[model samples]
Target chain A: MKDNKPEWYARMKRGPFEVTKFDSEMMRKVEERALIDRIKPRKKRFSPWAAAVATAIVLIGVYFLVPKSSLSYPDTQEVGAGKSEMTAEYVREHLKIGMAQEDVKNIFGNAAEGQSVKRDFAQPHQDDPNDMRTWTAVDIWRYDYGVGEGYSVHSDLEKDNGFDMPGIENGNIESQLVIVWKDNKVERAFYKYMSSKGLESTQIGPAIEDFPDTEPPISDEAKHDSEYPSLEVRAIGESTLGKFELRPRKGSAEKIQPLGAPSCLGLDTDLTITGDYELFFKATAGGESLIQNYEALEIIQKENKAIMMQKFDFPKVELYLFIPRYTDCHGLEFYAYGIDKKTGEASAFTFQEGDNAIPYWTTSPMVLPTQLDDQLVVEGGRFAGTDGATRYRFQPDLNKHQMMLEGKEQIP
Target chain B: MLTRDYLKYVSDIPTATLQELMEEHGQEVWNYAYFLTKNVDMSDDIAQDVFLRAFLHIASFRGQSTVRTWLFSITRNTAINYRKNAFFRKVTLLEWIHSASSASSAEEQYMSRTFTDTIWQLVLKLPPKYREVLVLDAKYELPLSEIASLLRVSSGTVKSRLHRARSKMKEFMKEVERREG
Candidate 1:
């Protein structure tokens, strides 16, 4: 205990620290003086002159930025033509069944054969049955100048022992096709070519009628399993500039497939089925029904056959529905169902009218339970003094579903 | 409620009773600031600012950490801010010692002391992470756990850093010893 080790331990021990001698008395007095310098409250201040100057500057800026150059002196002019004008590019883009008379002429230059034909409008009349108008004139164009001749012109004639001219193997001529239009609608079309049998003629009726019905050359089970079940709502096997990812909602019973090719109708095939399925399409935002743009969807069976079950052309004001295998479809309500007399493809469905679907503004705002009931009763101050106050009162017709909000003040 | 009596209550208590018992121990706090800044005036200013800020936000202080740890935390932040502001104008501890010694010829500059000069040169060369804990431990005699809290690191990490720092210092000292020999 009395060794050099004990002495060394004591020397290495942390030293006895001394206290700080800071004089904080002066600092305390300074803080008291600063607090005493503060005073009482004052009235609200106004700067009307500054506000007026800001307003004038904003108006001047707007005038320079958005000046009117149209007939309406102080108002901005509406952009683009009001009516939908069909152009050659638009024809190539949409590629609908019919093309106007002027468009065909512009595309083909001149018709090889021009003729007049009268046809009746057999579709249902809107108001007057006798109001049907008949179309009289139609034109057609064709080309048939040794089309394959250019490819074989330099080939040796002696090789095949004088086979009918170097390019003329089986009398297939190079030619341009022409379409005929009557009263702004395609009535007929045909191809022109040099025929040894003095211009062999082939008539191209209405583009839709001449769509080459080959009986599909496939079985019904093969079509249903491969093609019939597949919905070809739009252009199939056509090139789309891009692809998109589709994410199904959480806990949804339906299994979603990858987005397939877009059809001429503009709908993309998004699912294939083993069991029954119901597809729901809701607008991304709320607006008038006429403003809702059309989307196409197609379903193809395993053997590569398909059908367009739902085609959206009319104004979609409310909800749209489509049920595959309509005979198996139980609930029949509003909208019409197509019963293919040849195939018996029928389904019962309904399309509700008016603003029936849940609008994004209402459903999205009330996340908590209390917010929901408060939204339904129109009691929350959140919607006060706005268009939402009135709009919230009109509950969307969601098949009689209701939501309750908790812990919120009631709207008067 | 705070008045002259409160100030005296804090001040009149004997230095040993207040210095060892008080959480912040202002003398040691000021010394730490002084070492970082190498200026007595700035150190005093920083110490006063730390106390004022601490007093104002005292209600928010939950006493989860020791008073010394808290004060050092404030001192470190304030000193760093001051250094950043005066980045272009810097004065080394050796220069400061030289100036102080020049004013009073009786004392020699710490840089002139061979052992002190060697240690100072090696400490300055250390990375900021190791150097901070080393200076606080060696110069201010702060506990390793308290230094760890001030640096917001684990005590084991502080111990490892101190060990590495000492190893580096020993290596430097050995080189100096060789040169002198």
Candidate 2:
């Protein structure tokens, strides 16, 4: 046993042991026709119990399909509202990375508006539209008043940081505004209200840097005409991985501070923006917070402007949401955003009910998939504030929803 | 499509043809089992089990990897599971000690048998993972790439395991020489 250069170990280096002629012959005999012939053949058997169960299942299915107006029903108004709340919960769950554009429009409805700003990297000058040498940066922000909430392409930064401020708690409504900066100047602003109609009514600001040589010499007319005065208080951009909040300065025109700025957005100070910028805002009622959970926000900066991409990659699971009959079910979907820790490449996936169905249902309460395995590292969880709460929030005890991960199975 | 001729064609094919066509590689499978069980008879049994299981599941096989790699994977699993079973544990331990003592006595009677017996005993002393990689390369003639794929590890892992196995085996052999002398 003490021999270091054992013959077997040395032989193992050359390759597996050679099959001696006797060994091959012995194998042939043991594995030959007689063994194959001895294998027992299977036969199908009919069972009365199985037949009875199948019949009962078919009858129950027929009973649910039959329309019965005679059955006593709850009032439509209450039911409709309940259904809307459930639908909102469904949208929160089942959000995957790389969701399609059509799926977003379907969920939020056509009443939403989409806006974009392009930052050119080549021209360095704001006037050059066709600077071939510059990278064209685009930020598309969509707004939907009918859904009572809207989302911009880049405003999810706060949601990704575990700060569900305006949606969950009251009194902290002051921390719901977000500011977008380009080249270190305040470019755009977004805000969310705690009310059901959170972002329905908001104001827009003109370019602040456009005006020059008017320090401490402000007239009422100049304040009205300047874009700086018109800036709307908005939530800072939340990517799939990051969250930000911006609050306008109180009683002063020159100093606006970002709510929850340094810790949440990694910004040094609040009201500092020097170059051209674009900002978008999104607000929803009684859904999960986009903070707390792991998420990825991909920011692709091409010259002066940056495009922020969010990817939500929740595990494949079944989500049930109640929605009004009038609203399209097809629109109800989830988008997943994944942010690569090393390369900041954010990807998004939109999951639909018809395509991605829950394979089975269980009565056990739901839990985050990350807790089940140590190896599964959720990228956004580290920045999800101190409490490590879920990114999506839901109404208390009102919306009855189910979310489940589908078991892995081989594709047939 | 179901015809007598088709049945005859399948039946006429020799059973050895079934095993060969089934891609049941015998030598590699046996060598890998030997690495685990360290007993020639038990290794042969494990190799047979691997081939039989492969034959039964051949229809489900999709050619993702080579037939040799797949067969060796089955052999490794079969050998490991056999070693884990309570009955196999008791029997294998008893048999290992008995065989080692007997072989040692036999070597005393015949000096010529000492080298081979001593080498195999030292191989059994190496750690399980290292011994496995060495056996796969030396006895079975499997390439490092195929072994890496079979083990579901990086190529560097296979090389490192082999290196460790060689060093450990060498150390064991040196100790044996000192004790015997």
List the DockQ of the predictions in order: 0.02, 0.05
Per-residue accuracy of model 1 over A124-199 as CA lDDT, tens digit each: 3222211112222223322123344234222221221112232333444333233444455765443333334332
Let me know the TM-score candidate 1 reaches against the reference structure: 0.26
TM-score on alpha carbons, each prediction: 0.26, 0.31
Which CAPRI tier for candidate 2?
Answer: incorrect
Q: Which candidate should be chosen as best, given lDDT against the real structure?
A: 2
Clashes of 2: 85
lDDT of 2 by residue, B1-181 (tens): 1111222223133465555633445655665676677656567567766665555555434444455665666776666555543335555556546655565434223422322444655665676777777766666657766776666544544665676577667656656676787
iRMSD (1 decimal) for each model: 33.8, 26.5
